[model samples]
Target: VVYQRIGNIPGVRSASIVSGRNFFSGSGSSYGLGFVLLDSFEERDADSLSSEAITQKMFMRTAGIADAKIIFFTPPSVPGFGASDGFEVRLLDRTARDIRDLDQVATEFSGVLSQRPEISYANNSFSTTFPQLMMEVNIPKAKEAGVPVSDILSAMQGYIGGFYAADFSRFGKQFRVFVQSKPEDREEADDLNSIFVRNTQGEMAPISEFVSLERTYGPQTIGRFNLFNNVTLNGGAAPGYSSGDAIRAIQEEAEKLPADYDIAFSGITREEIASAGQAGIIFALSILFVYFFLAAQYESYVLPLAVLLSLPIGVAGAYASISLMGLENNIYFQIALIMLLGLLAKNAILIVEFARQRRQHGLSITEAAVEGARVRLRPILMTSFAFILGLLPLALANGVGAVGNRSIGTGAVGGLLVGTVIGVFVIPVLFIVFQYLQEKVSSKPAVIHSNETKPNV
Candidate 1:
């Protein structure tokens, strides 16, 4: 309604509601399995390994393996897969009993993406892609070397990963006590072996003696949506062009690659959610402000209703303006409609308040209305024209924020132009009707006075 009102302004060229684009599979929740091309493995070597062999090795070395393949397939339209850029391998595992356990593995897997430069953004289903490995030794493993599990666990925990104990006050500041091995030692297998685990007999034993330490890839730390692994590559678009256009271009480029891989864009939902939330907030605030203003001005609840009746006339003008001006129904125009309510009601208040005062003076309904309109007409016109003239400059301004400002200014000016003219004429007619009803209700005789006659003396 607001857009229509402002659109009719003479200088408004075009107005529209613009929003960000959502790609086919850009959302983090989308599912799919993607294969990462390992530089260490040659194409011929990867192809030579049977799918079963690959699956078994991955399962034994890592955790569960879903599907394994050599060269991934893409849609028919995409070009060469065999010689295309190396791909990142991803698998979906949503049915695990503990989702967080699986998420831990997925988080660790994301680390692999940062290790490679050729790969782009690796999307995942798991909410937390970082994984932390925690190890608890079996009593049997500790006892075999005559060591207490607690002693070994404490020493390893402190030396390997840093154990935080308590804070120490130093130089008027508190510093935490964190004990851990240096970075280089933590990364070496030989250094890890040097860790000493005390035996129950009070003898120090090498960590490698009884407990087997295997550094295997953590569980599927990241999650996949719909049981599919998805990836997205962020690239630049032409200046002044929309993201949608860039996505379509990228999609076309993707088609030129081999059809062995499945790729898509999926960021639309986020954009929609943001736009809806913003619009909803503005709409809610606008309504609340209008109600508050009306309630405060007229002490009687019924008088506010009469003022609100003038709103439809303003709304009708707004609609006509938008249609005539060719603007979109957007947030800026909505704000204009809100402003129009106040302007329209201002005019109505002038007429209604005047008529009300005259009625209080014991004037008849028709006499009160005509006299009110005659007295208020000049002031209403003057105020309305003054607002319109002030807004004209804003509507004509140019540059960075000019378009948005003009949209609002133009909408309000158009509505005010129409509303002020109609309000003056319509409010008087409405006041007359309402005043008559009020007077009739208040002037009724009391039942106890029916037969009583009192002389003037």
Candidate 2:
């Protein structure tokens, strides 16, 4: 039924259903799986035919399914990390309590996440309603019957669940054998009465007197994580939010869970959380590297601030543009930010380097600042506009890899546009302030040449 329904979805090119497990064999308890192949980009040109849109349609179409909990998810963009995109959170039972209790707590945790605005969906496959059998051994009854408790259990294991009897060597090969009762004799619980076990007296007795059977319910399989029983919740971030935001949201909500329960991230979410602060660190390091290079070039420690301080303006511009464009702060956007930093610093360097040269040649601080801006303005605009125009195709990209291209292009373009337009004015003022400070703190004035004319402002 689900296969046919998903096949009928507008953008689905093909749909297949498989029983027992998915292709990756990741879900041991999953009974059935469905694969949907979407139409090619050229065939599905409408915005409604996008992957998210088709997934939403699938959810709406399958909402009437009461016998099964249907979940739809996109495959992970990067392979070997997980089976699907989004966060994989393991809800751990540290004390190894009853499976039913774990199921109850996990369900409640998923429900709480579902209500969070940052989460699109939160659910787990762990279930405890499957029919199972409960076997009880009467230890006292076995002792009274002159039979050992281990003997009865060994008999049951051998007859119902099968046991490794022995290994024999034949024709230079080893053969292992298992023992189990005949299918007809093990058809029902009452059949156990016919299986006999020998007591210490060498007399045979039926095992029914020493064992009891009752129908119960439990999960078909249980999984452990970090050596504790765990239930995994698979979910994605809501629209307009990044995976980082979803992770933080889950962490905040997890604090409200019982002390015995803990949450651990796996796959992409784990990688994201593990490297959460790396971007800021990388940015700081990149700036420090540039600052040191500038210090060496100018042979002064205080002069690099004029170039480094102008970077925040470009960073602010990049962030403001993405927010206005309804884009998230993802890896591609951050990459653009690093590139933006280099470009903006290059523009600042042109003005500051020129202003320092004029100061050494006998120009006043204010005159040198004005002269530097006027001399470097044309080349800065020319280069900045050329770079921005070159990225226009990427900013308006379509088809494959469009999202990443757009992120990089849009961020770079926005940052450089704002930085170049405003930076020409700000760089000179920064140079004047930092230059005055550097001159005041120095022990001697720069070697001024009286033969050179003063810089014209």
Which regions of candidate 2 fall more than 4 Å away from where they truly are?
A: 22-30, 135-213, 443-457
Instruction: Please give the TM-score that candidate 2 achieves against the real structure.
Output: 0.82
Best by TM-score: 2
Lowest lDDT sum, 10 consecutive residues, model 2, at 22-31
For each candidate, give its TM-score against the true structure: 0.43, 0.82
156: Cα error in model 2, Å: 9.8
Each candidate's number of clashing pairs is 54, 0
- Residue-level lDDT tens digits of model 2 in 165-277: 89999999999999998889899988987999999999999999988888998886788889999998998888788888898899999999998999999888888888879
The digit string of per-residue lDDT tens for model 1 on 226-261 reads 555333232222223333344444444444433333
The 10-residue segment with the lowest total lDDT in model 1: 68-77
How far in Å is the alpha carbon of 32 misplaced in model 2?
1.5
Q: Give the local distance difference test score of model 1.
A: 0.55
Task: Tell me which residue pairs clash in candidate 2.
Answer: none
